[model samples]
Target chain A: MTGLNNKIHQALQQIHAEQALKDKTKAALKQKIQQYEKQKYKTEKRRLVAILACLCLLLIGGAGWFYFTPATTISIDINPSLEVGVNFFDRVVSVESYNDDGQELAASLDIRFMTYAQAIQEILETENITDLLSADEILTISVIGSDEQRCRRILSDIESYTAGQKNIYCYSAASDEVATAHEIGLSYGKYRAFLELQSLDPDITPEELQHMTMREIRDLIDSLSGNKQNENASDTHQGAGNGHGQNSGGGNRRQGR
Target chain B: MRSEQEVNKAIERYADTVRRLCMIYLKNETDTEDIFQTVFLKYVVSSVSFENEEHEKAWLIRVTINACKDVLKRFFRSHTISLNELMEQPEILEPDHTEVLEAVLSLPLKYKDVVYLHYYEGYTAPQISRILRKNVNTVYTLLTRSRQLLKEKLGGDGLE
Candidate 1:
């Protein structure tokens, strides 16, 4: 090579000799390689544990959701106006009310965690409903917006509840009829009128009343009032919400909003 | 892939060459050690099977060059560590040798690399082009320009 290249070569040799990898640096790199190999082994183990933990959490969460959530919601609207939510094991887990009377009834009774039968017994004993019920009066319990399976479960529970009880006949109205009643702004009043109308005429069944529209129920109530020549009968039916003290033999219980 | 024993031997053989490349690129112990560890670690873990010692040496040199480039690119427009910081102890050299070495280091980054590969490492222009992934003509042009710049900086003694 040339003189300059020769000189550079000599200088590079000196720098190379001076800058050899320190013994400490070589040992440090060897240690790092060993650590890297060990880390590779643990990576798979850690990832598998993480996946298993995630699966366990998912299973627990699914079981909790299935157990805690209500399987059926039974909305009883006999002017007492309460919704009883039953779990998979037929235990009442929730009681919600849509009106003032139901609110008072809900507060007076802590029926949660009781069996469906016990809860219905509690509902019957509450002054909220007992005051509204006459000896021969039919209690109309309707299922709110729910699936067919849940509706069947709720209806079955109510039947079982009223079987042993005396003078308490539980009639189930269609969920659609209840929805229509709610839509018409006088669900509880119309439901009470329908029940009274049913008891007056044994031919007019619960299914027949459930099928009738709100206008039909109103006309039927007016015609029945006229036939009885009861002047206060029309007032009781019309002013059910206003005259809470006048318990006019059947038709007048305040509609729950 | 080299066996563990082979890898250890290769590390001993080429560790100084990588250290020199890192010194030329980065001018601090921290940066130098970082590149040194990376180069050896790659040698230990790489799966490529070299044809021979020359191929293995060339691959190591290429990896070293690329590693140095990465370090420099990280701080390209930011602060550059000077060669003064790199020279742990000034080697007692003849005036010509010291002056030439300083002039080469003072050259631009691309030119400094080509000059070091050609002169210090005794690599041909074509070999440097392959190692640096540069065109042969590009390497020759850099060498020419760098020699000219060094001539100006160190007078006639630059690349005589």
Candidate 2:
């Protein structure tokens, strides 16, 4: 048995793998490894591209949101009650109307993306607005914002530009007050007039006042409060022009020069 | 993936053992070449870390045997070859050694691994059982039957 085992071992020892076979296998394995590395690289590159594309989409969408979001609102009320939304850059981003006449006026104006000053100028120069001004109608411009300093700057700029015009009142109010005004479907100007009238008459409704001009609402408030001196006055009334217009309904009234 | 240096070392060390196992199972040079590539390629891609040289040798032996069986199971290929093509340089083998090798190769497929491992590789029945994943008693029975068969093929005198 030992001799048989030794002979089997000796015979097996004589058999060695040729050098050519080992070389061929090493060459083949090297080629396969290269292919594997290339495939891995391509897969990683594809993943990186997908991530970059998603980031780019998020950046574009965020910029669009930043450019279009409103930071301050200017409510213009003179029978046709409407509001213009201004972005952080002071550009008018939206115009919304609360009545049929305001809708018609809004449709006739293309003030989007314009500066608030330009938009207000365009509104005052419109034929309908010019005709109303000539007939002694009151146009109230209310600047609503969270930032008091920014609102005051805007109100000062507006008062200076409309200094020569008659019966155009400019003031600023807090955003919370404007939000309350919007809940009842009234622009901030008409809402202040409504508050004044409500305090005097206690029966004046927003619906009853929606179609009335700012001049008419002021006359109603003056008539109910028995302050008849300001009635039929064609001069402008500037409401304190303080960025915080909390007392704008009664205590803030000032005769315009 | 194994490094190039590691793969070269394994080929140098285990190439003879793999070639001998290939001779035990396959009857042709092409099949032996196929088994060589298949076994070495598996070693290259395998993440198995061995504790020592014995563990690696056992793994290579098992893989070479399985690769041989897989080639044989392919129904499309022929398994027959002339006796001259059986050994790759038959001139080096003495007449007595050639007779002994031919006798071992002619053994039944189930007995070939047991005879080679027990006689030439010096593995006991229990160790062969562990390598082949078989019952220790079953390995002893196979070794007994293979010893009897080898004795009959060669002369019974001086045969264990």
Candidate 3:
């Protein structure tokens, strides 16, 4: 068995040795290996990109949660004050005050889970606001940890509430426009008017402009510029509708066209 | 994964062995070439760390056999060219060893596989059993039956 197996082995070896793999086949095999390597690299890179994209999405979601969240604390200071802490749904969580007058007012008012607008109206009615805000006094309204849009909307609401009242100017500290104007040594109301007047007629009298609100001065400027009854009557109406800060000048500054 | 240079070296060393195994199992050039490529491509893509060159060789043999089996299962078995026909074909098998080679090829696949691994590859029965995933007793039985068949086909005389 051993002798015959050896001879058959030798014969098969001769047969095996005689046939060689063609050069083309060897080259094709190498090419296949190279292709496989490239495919593996691409798969690895795609996996890494997918992981990074998920991480980036997580980071953006976290930042957005931190930035655009609505405020929990709506601080209304008619000095005698009112501070209300609310949730994202605008339900009042707690109401507290630092001063004795504010404490007394906070105790008297029941603003729990009340919408901020309702709470403000309730506080105004509950407190003797006339005594709290006497002549030569301003009310400061600030919202903490909130986006600008919500803060400005709430500020506008409060400002409208105090509009016809005597000796009350609302300072909306959270408003960007208001804060930037205050930084530049002008109240938000006056600065807004300055911008409007400057855009309308650059040479409009900027003198004693500080004493006028946006609407009073815009109306004064409209009467003086004589463009109020012009062909663009809709534009004039739009301006009147959106006017902010109405300060009464000494009289009217409508000097005539 | 094997590097390009490492893969190239492996192809150089083992391409002929794979071809020989395929040739022994299948007689068609197309089938042989198909299995040859599959075996090498699988080696390139496999992440298995071989213990040594012998282990790698055994892996290639086993994969080539499995790949051939898969192809056999996938397609209807075409009639393989008989060794008598191969011997008659010009410039195919050398005339001197064609008789013994034909005798080996004429056996059944089960017997021929053990014959090739034992005689040409020089593996022991235990080693053949491991490579072919058969019992050692089964491998020894197949080898003995194959020898008897080869001797009977070759007129009961060993090749000179």
Candidate 4:
């Protein structure tokens, strides 16, 4: 067996793999490796594209939220009571109507995306508003917001724009007061008048006042307060002589006639 | 995956041992080529780190043995080959060495690996057990049986 083991070792020693076999294997391995690298690169590129697509969607969604969110509200109250929501860029983002007449006016007007000043000028030039102003009907504009400085700036701009107009009033009120006004289905301007009327005539209901124009509410408040005798004296002053202050919880009336 | 340089070095180092194992298990050159490609490809893709050259050699031996077994177990394989076809360089071997190699290859499949690993490779029973993943006593029994079979086939003139 020992001699046989020696013979076996010498015999096996003569059997080595040919150089041709090793060359063939190396060529096959190189080809397979190249294919593997190409497959890996394609998979990585697909993953990168998916990530970029998700990032673009997130950026577009964020920009949409920033552009559409309202930062303040401007309520224009007359026979047509409605509010225009203004974004941080001073553009009108929304217009919400509180009455049938307001809804008609809102439907007829295309004031969205316009600057607040342009929207207000558009509203004042409308036939309904021009006719009402000539007939001595009162138009009240209220600026509603959480930021005091922005509200004051908006109110000053509004007052300057309507300086020559008669029977128009502007004021600033806080967001909490506007929230209370919305609860009873009223614009902030009409809600302020309701509060004044409720103080003078405790029997005056919001339901009764909802259909009434701003002039009618003012006359009812004057008759209830016994100030009808001073009505002509108040009308003599065009856009001055009305109380304009920072009203934290109520209307700071900027102009009245 | 291993670099081409590393794979080349491994092929140069272990090709002989692998060829010997392939000859002992699979007698045909086609099956030997299959086992060669499979075993080297496995080495290229494997991430296992070796502690020493001996460890790497043992791993290659174990992989080659398993690859040969898988080829042999295939249902469509042509299992028979003459001794002349089996030897790539039959003209180089003397008659005595040819007789010894024939006797070694004629053993049953179970005894061939133990005989080759023990006699030619000089692996102990315990080392063969570790390489083949079998019990030490089983390796010892296989070695003793294979020696008895070889002695029976060849004359006992130079037997231990």
lDDT of 1 by residue, A39-130 (tens): 97799789999999999999999887776677665666554467777778778888876566567778889888898778878788776565
Docking quality class, candidate 2: acceptable
Each model's lDDT? 0.64, 0.80, 0.63, 0.84
lDDT of 2 by residue, A184-215 (tens): 98888999888888888887788898889987
Q: On residues A89-125, what C-alpha lDDT tens digit does candidate 4 reach at each position?
A: 9999999999999999999999999999999999989
- Model 4 residue A174 CA deviation (Å) reads 6.3
Q: What fnat does each of the candidate structures reach?
A: 0.51, 0.51, 0.38, 0.69
- In model 3, which regions exceed 4 Å deviation? A17-22, A70-72, A75-257, B78-80, B88-92, B158-160
> Of the pair 1 and 3, which is ahead by lDDT?
1
Residue A15 of model 2 has an lDDT of 65
By DockQ, is 1 or 2 better?
2
Worst 10 residues of 3 chain A by lDDT: A248-257
Q: How is the predicted docking of candidate 3 categorized under the CAPRI scheme? A: incorrect
The most accurate candidate by lDDT is: 4
Winner on lDDT (2 vs 4): 4
1 versus 2: better TM-score goes to: 2
TM-score of the first chain alone, every candidate: 0.54, 0.83, 0.39, 0.81
Chain B TM-score against the true chain B, each candidate: 0.85, 0.92, 0.89, 0.93
Recovered native contacts, candidate 1: 0.51
Q: Give the candidates in order of DockQ, highest first.
A: 4, 2, 1, 3
Leading candidate by TM-score: 4
Question: What DockQ does every candidate get?
Answer: 0.39, 0.48, 0.21, 0.57
